[model samples]
Every structure is written in structure tokens, then in C-alpha cells.
Target: MKPFSVAYTSACHFGVIAAVHLPDDPAPVPDGVLGQLPEVERDHARTLGGYRQVSFVGGRLALHRAIRGLGRRAGPVLPGEGGQPQLPEGVAASISHKRTLAVALAARDTHGSVGVDLEDLGPARMGIADRVLVASERALVDQLPAQRQWTAVLLRFSLKEAIYKALYPYVNRYVGFEEAEVTPLRDCQADVALHLKEGEGPFLVEARYQWMDGHVMSTVRIRSGTPAPE
Candidate 1:
């Protein structure tokens, strides 16, 4: 297999986004690439079948590149609870991928956990809107022009996925789609409102997104341990 290459890299509010393009053929990843990863990651990749292994390896490659961009040596990104990336101390990171591309976001853990997600700009599938959006969000989508509704739903979906990733490390639980609402603003930014059940309160979260090679890339940062407002 040909070596994977860095597609692009950009700075986001939370950290840096690194995207890598996977090989066109679905052939197994080359030993050279696999050899570069930590033994644990290599073993885990071995267990995954077909394109899954490809995605896993590509995501780690992108992550290592992102870490290097931060002037840090890349460490083993083991799978933590829920298979999230177990980043090195003082680092926060997230990974997402499509068939041909993998993206990662990495930042210093000074502020909080960070998450990143990538989604293709395909037409929305039927009934996906109902599944992803809360009532109010659905109402907002309904007001958009017909052609833009799909993008609207997808933008919120991508943002919510990033939001969940950023918050899950702190909450240590499954946060439902309804648990948070995203109101997208201009300039590829959005505001998130968390409605966690009593006792899950007090996380400061923010999100941003951009278009990359016909895909929607979203990211979020979450700060925990703060007291709820009086």
C-alpha cells in the first residue's frame, strides 16, 4: 500500500486540526506504517477487520502529526473508556474519519478535553433529522430554505457529536442527543446548551466547525469542575 499523506492542518479555537488522506485501495495498511505505531495500537488494529483497521491506523497517524505540530513527542494513544483516545498527560485529543480521510484535533490539556468529528456533505438520509435534532432544533431547521435544511441538520449533527466527545471524559457517561442543544451562529461557530440531569451540571463547552474537502469538520472544548451559576 502507498504511504498515507497529510491532507491539511489548521488551527482551531481549541487546538490544531490535522487531516490525513488514506490510500484509495482498501488494501491492508503497510507494515511500515503499522510499525510506526505503538505495539498496543498495532495489536488493536489487528483485531479490527477491513476498512476499520485502515481508519484506526489513519486516525492515529493524523493524531501523531497533530501532537508533533504542538511541539510534543507523540505517545501511545491507547483506547480508554468507550474507545476514546487515551492521550498523553497534559494533552487532549479526538479523532474522526471517513472512508478516504481521517482527522484529529490535539491541544494542551490546560483548559479541558477536546473533540473533533468529520462528516461527508452527502444529502441527509430520510428520518435522520428526527433522530438527531430536538424539537426546537427541528423547528429551526424547518424555517430554513429547502435546499439548506440538509446542511442545517448535518451541521448540528456534527457539532453534537463533537460536543459529546468533549464532554464524555468529564461526565463518564452516555450523553443523549437531547442532553445538549446547538444553536449555530455565523462564521462557522455555534453555542451549546447542556441540559444534563441534576448533578451533571457545570461544564463550560464551546464548538466550532469548518468545511474541509467537501466534509464538515467540527470541534469542541469542555471545561469541568466549575461551580454552577447562582
Candidate 2:
């Protein structure tokens, strides 16, 4: 109930979910991160790298609050597969990020778990889909009104990444854009559907995408162990 910042949250078979926004600050040239950043990323950082450390702080704090809040009722935090943070023993958890938010979810009776994400919308990049967007996705994104296509592209890209992070620890399977298709629901307030293709993938993934405050934020949550509700 804390004014816990969030990009997304949901009740699960486990406990509760918390998502924090990773504030964008001018990033300092940290020894390791700078070296690891791609050439292009490095170039961008060069312009205003002085305050880029808040990327996940908001999400981290929000997660802690969620854990604390859940602990008040469920217990403490536990670590999950790949050293991911989870609820105390006998609990399951998942974390996700998009642009400036990180979300964490937990429950006592879920296997697949929960995840959330946030994405910032900006000017259209030249041919992003050529590399990240799948063929069909590219076609769909391109089909949007010229003015709206970029938002749609960013929306899909952000949601897909969140879905990947949400299910990665449990499924441990590589998910490309083709594996997950996103369809936005229509309404003043709508949610995005993270449709896992027919195969060995997350059976049901739920997500929400919103264009607010001049940025596109998206959240993805997947429930595990429980069979997909028809």
C-alpha cells in the first residue's frame, strides 16, 4: 500500500508483485559497464554520462517494498533459479524491467511466476526491426499508420523483452520476437496480450502497455505451475 512506485503489479498464487522504475541519470563511466557497453551505447553515454546510475533504483526500491509488504503477510524474500530474488522458502518469484521500471512478483503456490516491464517511447529509429523484430512483426508494425507505427514498434519490442525476462528463469528457453506475439486491446485503458505461440513456451503471459507522460511503459506478468485458463 506504500506509494511504492510501479510500472506494474499483480496478485498471484504466490504473494504480491512490485515494479520500480529505473530512473535515467547521466551515467558515469563505470570501469566495467562502460567497457561492456556496445560502441553505439558508449557513444550515446558520452553525451550525458554523468547521471546514468538511476536505471534500476526505482525498480529495486519498489521490489524491496513489495518484499517487505508481502513479508508482513507472507514472509521474507527468497532466491529463485539463477540466483533471482524470491520470497522466503516455499515461495516463487520473478522480476522484469523495461525502460525505467523493474517489477518483482511472488506467490506461495505458483511455478511459472510473475514479471513486469517499462519502456520509454522516443523518435523512431531507422530500421530496428531488421535485427530485433521478427519478419511477421515487422510487417505488422510497418502496417500501422506512418505516425503511429513507431509507437507500435516500441510497444512490441518493450513488451517482448519484459516477457523474456519474466519467463527466462523458469523456462530457461531462448525467446525471440517470433516466439511471442503481442496484441493490444482496445479501450481508453487497455492491456497487451503476450501470446506465446503453440509449443513449449510460457502458456499464458499478460502484459499492459500505456503511452503516458510522453513515454511508452509496458508490463509483462506470467503465471507458472497453474495450467492456462481457457
lDDT of 1 by residue, 1-230 (tens): 24468888877788888888887566788888888788888988888777888999999989998988788876678888787887789999999988789999999999999989899998566378888899999999999898899989999999999998898788888888888899999988898888897568588887898886689989999997664779
Q: Who wins the lDDT comparison? A: 1
lDDT of each: 0.86, 0.55
- The list of candidate 1 runs beyond 4 A from truth reads 1-3, 225-230
Candidate 2 ranges with C-alpha deviation above 4 Å: 1-53, 71-111, 187-202, 224-230
Which 10 consecutive positions of candidate 2 have the poorest summed lDDT? 49-58
- Per-candidate TM equals 0.93, 0.61
* TM-score of model 2 (CA atoms): 0.61
Q: Which predicted model would earn the best TM-score?
A: 1
Model 2, span 20-127: residue lDDT tens: 545444345454443333354345444553333343333344555565556544333333455455445544455555544556655543445555545556667747
Candidate 1, position 97, lDDT? 88
